[model samples]
Target: MTQALSQTRTGGPALPQERRLVTDIPGPRSTELLARKKAAVADGVGTTLPVFVEAAGGGVIVDADGNSLIDLGSGIAVVSVGNAAPGVVRAVTEQVAAFTHTCFMVTPYAGYVEVCEALAELTPGDHAKKSALFNSGAEAVENAVKIARVATGRDAVGVFDHAYHGRTNLTMAMTAKNMPYKNGFGPFASEIYRAPMSYPFRDGLSGEEAAARAIDHLDKQVGVANLACIAIEPILGEGGFIEPAPGFLPALAAWAKDNGVLFIADEIQSGFCRTGAWFAVDDEGVIPDLVTTAKGIAGGLPLAGVTGRAEIMDSVHVGGLGGTYGGNPVACAAALGSIAEMKEHRLDARALEIGTLIRGRLEKLAAEHAVIADIRGRGAMQAIELCAPGTKDPDAARAAAVSAYCHKSGVVTLTCGTWGNVFRFLPPLVISDALLEEAFDVVAEAFAATA
Candidate 1:
């Protein structure tokens, strides 16, 4: 019998939890759409899956060709609370009915204030905090830098190797990757310096040692007095889901504090219970002076925020901050709804359960397969790096083959990493054990056939 999943929500569809393939991977309709897309859409905008999505909820995404594929990417960790969630749909519907855009800068609304209040309450610190919302993670990050500079009267910003901040010019400079992100886009903003990051599997350095090395580099290279802030992702997202060794973040935070440099945690991908905590910095009791959030903030809406200590955030003049659509009322409503779903469902605990389940399956696969190099990340945000058998050399081709196999087999998966050799798994917190297990069964098959 086909697995019968629970209904999504009041207005949400009752999607089947099981993966089903009615036709080959992209089918005919998707192929036709692809041709249209190629003719119309820019070549730079790429699609991971050739098929177009018609519906998504619970643990599956139904494609235009009527094939239900198990969702493992969660729209790159944007739909952590699940797609078409009840609260999100209800909130957006009601907000759109009332009014669309008032230009919060000219005329503010309650929803924006509520979201800022919620951000103050949820983000890591207990101290008084304030937030400024924007449209994307890059905006949040860029604004964080602005706030840091204004507060400290410094020029240089510090970032680590293998970090992915965003694509905006300022953040593009902060991001560590070259190709696809920074290549041919030079003449980037100045005064951004890069330091070493702690990669346990490859660097083999303890967290303390790595932090010391990085701190020394910063002091010598940038000079503490000239540095404004040190921004880092608690767990790297696109540059591989690389988790720094234990003690690394706390040490960095301490150094920044003692040196009067701000610590910024770019939690764009790891916040909102995606990492078994409200924010990944919460795991080690390391509170950042500023946090940039976006991806999972508003039930997939286009909303981002930079939350920080009141004094730091208020350093700017009254009219110094805000944009035309910084905090759209509709987006704020969606944020409130998303937060409600996350809190009500206790998705943090759910993420932990997901981490345990997926880790067990990946561990078994790694033991049986030599190409499975390392398993890392926390909560539902886990990944497995692929490498040459018995060696740490990255095998991007093998990773591509395995990902292609999964896509062909009715599973929606995504591969990331600086070398493009890590298979990232960011399933919605609402995913069922049965569906996850089934997805991994296909992954195991991919390894057996392609690896």
Candidate 2:
């Protein structure tokens, strides 16, 4: 690290933005907590890293043992405004003191309405829009499907290969992976169909060709008349940070409009400035009929929303939507604050800067390491797919080894992909360029050591 890269406090956190290790990762306190967690928590609740966090902000998470680890995962892309962001903190504090919850469905609140208005203004399309808030990405997705089905009077919903919607029964059926997300959980919901995705690295097809193939499959397998909506992540997230080839999304959107099918953009993990745009679909000028958002929307609070054309969103019966905790007052406040922070800071531009730095570093690493089969994604949401040295065979073992190396070295990295051969990077947008370079240096070392 250079003197110019010296640590400086950012994100208004109490701790300085620096990586410090006083003990081994998952050190004494975290290990003890792990033991307690094992005894009290369910075995199914898996963790990427064993270290238990005491506090986190900017780009570092402080563990119980005083180890300050660089945060590259951003709690699975949920804290893009940075953990404990000042705006979120202040809004949440005031809201909590005023009132916790009267239930939005019962009495409603200004925060919830304000958040809906923000979503309407921010999401793609100049047409009149409406929004319904939910508690998670899954809830938003499920609701979007419900709205589409009601509006179109169609039963079938289409998803793409390598897609991951959520853990709910309906979303599980829509998800492509079967291991942990689907496994024994089914019997799942009906009328859920799967289609091919535009994965440029693997398929080697042009965007227009790939979209044609997907449309062909849907038309043959599930007729357009029967399909309610074709939901997709503008940039695939859990399935790997796969950005569909250029022109692919626009083609699909055109097809959906030609037919009566609703084009639902699942922006759960890629929205809120994480992808250098308000939403990934904006890159290709694809205006989706329905857009689902979560993860980074509320700093770290649980809030999700489905925003779309006014008529379609209002198609569903008044009481047909909503849950007990869908738009909790506190979460709504956090969403307001989070959106304020994003607009004030222009984190979208910051994401572009961070992406340029990280992608450039990874490109250099890829040039050196044959194990890096592909490097892809936009803004802070980037990833490298690990493969055998001489072939395109997925090398999940190498990915695992590198992740372990990162964990031991006190960098909180994450891995994802259908085959588990992808090392994804989702650093907080608030992360400084110097810190990002430091994290990439650690990543480079891991690749070299593992190789």
Best by lDDT: 1
User: lDDT tens digits, residues 1-451, model 2?
Assistant: 2222223224453677877889988899999999999999999999989999888888889999999999999999999988888889999999999999998889988988999999999999999999999999999999999999999999999999999999999999999998889998889999999999999999999999999999999999999999999999998998988889999999999999999999999999999999899899999899999999999999999999999999998899879999989889999999999999899888899899889999999999999999999999998899999989878799999999999999999899999999999989999888877778888889989999998
TM match of model 1 to true structure: 0.98
After TM-score superposition, the amount by which residue 119's alpha carbon in candidate 2 deviates from its true location, in angstroms, is 0.4
Q: For model 1, how big is the CA root-mean-square deviation?
A: 1.6
What lDDT does each candidate get?
A: 0.92, 0.91
How many angstroms is residue 373 displaced in model 1 relative to the true structure, after the best TM-score fit?
Answer: 1.2
lDDT of 1: 0.92
Q: In candidate 1, what are the lDDT values of residues 366-422, reduced to their tens digit?
A: 999999999999999999999998899999999999999999999999999999999
Which regions of candidate 1 deviate over 4 angstroms? 1-6, 9-13
Model 2 residue 55 CA deviation in Å:
0.7
Give the backbone clash total of model 1: 0
